[model samples]
Target chain A: MMSRKVRKYFSFTAFVLPAFLFYFSLSLLPTMQGLFYSFTNWHFMNPKYGFVGLQNFINIFTKDRYFVMALKNTFKLVAALVILQPLIALLLALMIEACAKWLQKIFRTVIFVPYMISTIVGTFMWSFVFRQVFTQIGSSIPLLGFLNQSWLSNVDLAFWSIIIVSLWHGTPLLMVIFLAGLAGVPVQLKEAAVIDGAKPSQVFWHIKLPLIFYSLTICMFLTIKDAFKSYEIVYALTGGGPGWATQVMTLNIFEEAFSGNYMFGYASAKAVVFLLIVLVFTVAQLLLMKRREVEL
Target chain B: MTRRITPLYVLNILLLTLLALIFLFPILIGFLNSFKSFQEIFLSTLSLPKSWSLDNYITVFQRIKLLRSTGNTAIVSALAIAGIVLFGAMAGYKLSRTRTKYSTVIFLLFISSMLVPFHAIMIPLYQMASKLQLKGHLPGLSVLYIGLGVSLSIFMFHGFTKSISREMEEAASIDGSSEFGTFFRIILPLLRPAMGTIIVQMFIWTWNDYLLPVLMLLDMRQFTIVLSVNTLFGEYGNQWNLILPALIMAVIPVIIIYIFFQRYIMQGVLEGAIKG
Candidate 1:
């Protein structure tokens, strides 16, 4: 028994120690340091620092317009994606599924191609399109003169531009999830619903919708998560632009840390707050959606 | 019923097609714009240029030391993938099979980390790296990559390895093989598919990553492809000719690698989506 215990203990450590050390030192250390620095007024340049309790959080709440705007924009984006985007994606998915088998893959590929591009690439593509091509198209067409707007440069338009581009890049992911969910839905149920003399709306509202409730919930979680971590596209497009109008939390944290004199501790506080917001949003979404998930 | 579905479907398809065209438009413009002279790219950024030229590619290649930067990126990414897969698999095997208090704790730590955004700790991390003198070099970059990548890599491996039988391990051990040899000869071979997927994923992420490279690589010489792309944004003239080509050239290798590993790479991502 002693020998058996020794053998297992040795083998486990041999397997786990190498990875545990690296992961702890690099990933866990940074996380812990973030927690520590959140309590201190630590700047990158100044090596020596004293602990400053809750001042950063207070400043952000009281004085920091940037953090306030970021919080507002993040919530706004989350609401839009969770509420509006999914409806559009679901419609697209249902339509495509009902459309035809022959063209099923064609639409899927067309929609999903955007998801493959990096955020930087996606934002860059839209910048070129909105600023150049959209302008050109708008200017060329006489009847559609009012439709053409400068999307990226204007503060009012930039937020929507980010949202639209996000939908363009991200809707396919929803479509894919919905497609997977749609495929999982048994065909026999629809036939049963039809035989029961139900109207199309009744059949859909009662049958197809309830079946893919899990998918909707998962998609909502993903959409919210992506919304909070919305970094690269916003950063690339306007640099939280037009005087901090579009600055989300990630942008605020980045600008706080790297762009100016490094308020490392202050940045840590902002990041923690951002993390808490994301956590609350995610947990709330999960709880809300989990109630709707129909058990098989 | 299907016939009645046609109109809505047709409208949807048409809308999607138009969207796809718009989606594809920027890259097309980027491609065409690359060939146009800087004067042409700026003057008629929207229209087709009368004369196509190789000046942009030529300029970027000459000015940016394109080959050297590519070599640096390739080497760093390759080493990163190698370390991530090997270490992730070993660690995953242990945690999945063994029932220990530490295993649960370690696994939870790794999994919970997937939610934390990198920016949260990036400054402290940079400070740590600076303190350790692991700054602006290949070894330093690869070490950082391993740290960032291992959690997800291990998670993937854990899921894949969990589906396998422990009987194989016992059989190999009874044949007088060392535990390391058992893993190397048997389990590693069986895990080829998942590991292949992880390799391609780790490679692409490490290669295309812009932020870490910029933050770490202080020297102009160590600039990766994305870093070099920013070099095109100069104070004067802003060299769209040079920049466009640099962007195109940067993506070319990525395109090639993806094409080669496209199937596995896609499955890898799909698999990772569930895990992530």
Candidate 2:
């Protein structure tokens, strides 16, 4: 009946309106306002401001030295993560898969413990290790004296420290994803490959790699997004210290708006630019990876 | 069946054990050092604690108001996650079951917003929070989290609802059950796995979130666990005894949660990554 149809439609509205209402006001509206604010000179404190058109964006590209440094650092970190995250994750997944069942579970659990810890906590713990514990060890054990360098103070080492800490915390989730992908690899296919006198390495190269390429794509995409958006690790660990040597884009944006300078409009522009870069990078990576996924 | 171990298997076990040790070294060191006095830690960061004392923990507990902040975190995470689950479930199930243009549009609206990272909107979000008087309010922050979190929750539920059949709802409707009754009594109970996955994922997220709380929580008493521990770093520079104990206390609960819900958490990670 028409009444039944009307009631059904009303139920759909009833179900959806609650979430939509919350999402629209807080998420979507803020995002849209951010986009609008990007074009205006909106300071956090000063109420009187005028339209700036593309001035904020132009300044970011040409004049903002800090922004450029942050951009360079973000790219460097993203590049490292894109390559190393998948490599280490896939390697660990393969290693775990080859283990006996119980060992696999234990190893997976142990590695994933870091990922469960808050990034702030994990990074702080690593900070102590890099700052105090490593130095102590290096002094006590002469052979390990190389570890005594100012890990978070020296410019180059600090960058790498961020990468190391990021990888330690990030790799496990991707490894688990890789594990899931590897689990889906048919036992029959691998067994068949082995029966055909294929070597272990050969089976991995010819069979397992292709089958898990989808997971590889997903991991790469996630890595790029996370790397570009990386904040807490660098923020809590180094505070972009030693003269902003390791400031990433997110940190740069936060500093621009909140830390000292209340340049809300300029920060909005930087944020928009950062968002565009993330979108372009992730979308491009997804496209590139999609083409290489082996059809089963 | 009895299986013969190979040289390769021996190598695998050794390599895995080594990697596991490397992964766990920081936490192990932190745990050991947390029990040490400041002077003891400074004397030898590598050595086992001279005395396994609870002094630092007790000091940290009082300093950070551990129970109060954790209770605050629990309140926020619980309220946000509950709203997300209930709202996401209802909307996602209905959208999946409905065959209408409006459903498609609404679904698209939810999914597309997932791409906007928090950084992009954080400035304006700060403004909105102040305007709405949600700033520095704990329950208000939870409401904001529900708003921020619902997109992904809805996305997951939408994907999950596809794997569920509509026949049960139809059966219930034929039996003259109200739609709300049918959903709450039937569809929801069957959505336990997806619910488990989201609950674990969101709990970890909301519990450990630092940036949002930092932005929203203005008062010291409003600090969540991570925020409280973060203050330790600033107030006690290189005071390893206090900082390490607080960090340990902050991190240990989530590890315990992970131990219990490891499967769901990992599954959620895989599902979220692949789907997103």
Top-lDDT structure, candidate number = 2
Q: Which lDDT value does model 1 have at A181?
A: 79
Docking class for model 1 is: acceptable
Best-fitting candidate, scored by TM-score: 2
**A177-262 per-residue lDDT for model 1 (tens digits):** 78877877787888788888988688778888899898888788788888888887787677788788888888888888998759
TM-score of each: 0.91, 0.98
What ranges in model 1 sit over 4 Å off? A99-102, A191-204, B1-5, B234-239
Candidate 1, residue B84: how far the Cα is off, in Å: 2.1
Cα lDDT tens digits, model 2, A1-296, are: 56978887788889999999989989999989998999989999998888999999999999999999999999999999989999999999998998778888999989989888999999999999999999898888999999988899999999999999999989999999999999999999988988899998999999999999999998998899889989999998889976899999999999999999999999999999998998889889989989999877
**Candidate 2: C-alpha RMSD after superposition:** 1.4
Q: Alpha carbon lDDT of residue B102, candidate 1?
A: 77
lDDT of 2 by residue, B82-108 (tens): 999999899888888888888899899
The Cα error of candidate 2 at residue B182, in Å, is: 1.2
Cα lDDT of model 1 by residue, B67-140, tens digit: 98888887888888888898899998888887778788888888777776677778778887887777898778
Q: Against the correct fold, how does model 2 do in TM-score?
A: 0.98
- Per-residue lDDT for B35 in model 1? 83
| Reference-based lDDT, residue A190, model 1 | 80
